[model samples]
Target: MLRITAGKLAGAMRGALVGNSTRVAAVRSLHGTEESAEEFDKRYEKYFSREGIDGWEIRKGMNDLLGMDLVPSPKIVEAGLRAARRVNDIALAIRWLEGCKYKCGDQMATLYPYILEKVTPTLKELGVPTLEELGYDKPELALKSVYDQ
Candidate 1:
């Protein structure tokens, strides 16, 4: 809360601060290595498949999954979908698929099919319809203006 300004006082304060500084340029690794993809998958799968998971938790988990830069592994996606099913939110599950599609970018054509292939059996067992089945593969209610037509 103290602000030392100008002249000799400022110089002395700056010197004291720098001398007492405990900050280090080198930081130690907590785990010494990054989490392996398998560890990441198991962690998220456990997170979504925990007992008594609710809609909010499912949404939170989905948001976390989407926020990550990498496309989630199929097991993680299946676990999240199953969590959505546990909460009885078909809409959320569909949105999760959309997020996954967004995460896949141009690779969707290649990756999504495989993701679907992996999760299809689970989707059938859960009775959750995909965005395509719900008619969301195309934009909703496209109207061509007469001027443009």
Candidate 2:
């Protein structure tokens, strides 16, 4: 006979298997507790630091972090970049780093520098370039647009 479960345990398992953040969040809230920012960042860092993480998972992880409301910690960014490098994806790695800077928003002036300070060594170690270094910081500088072709 097949068994069906609609209990909290089932929801937890489903949340884990489905990788649905909303459902996972609902389950946590229903339990009267939510993860702290540090815990959240640590969890993501651990996720990204997993061995044998493929390109799809790396992109998915970056997208998940980007979709979040808060900016990721420098350690998390470093971990993600390391993962990206592991998957041989320097281009996507740069994009993810840029996404982190964009996430800084109004705090870009203050917080971005701190993130850069913390992650600079890792960036250099991984040989990942920032948008500015790639001349992406000024897209308007392009002499010819793709539309002009």
Highest TM-score among the candidates is held by which one?
Answer: 1
In candidate 2, stretches whose alpha carbon ends up further than 4 angstroms from where it belongs are 1-28, 142-149
Cα lDDT tens digits, model 1, 34-143, are 88999999999999999998899889888988887899999999999999888888888899988997799989899998998998999999998877888888888888
RMSD of 1: 5.5
lDDT of 1: 0.87
lDDT of 2 at 27: 83
Model 2 TM-score, all chains together: 0.72
lDDT of 2 by residue, 40-87 (tens): 889889999998889999899899888989898998999999999998
In order, candidate lDDTs are: 0.87, 0.87
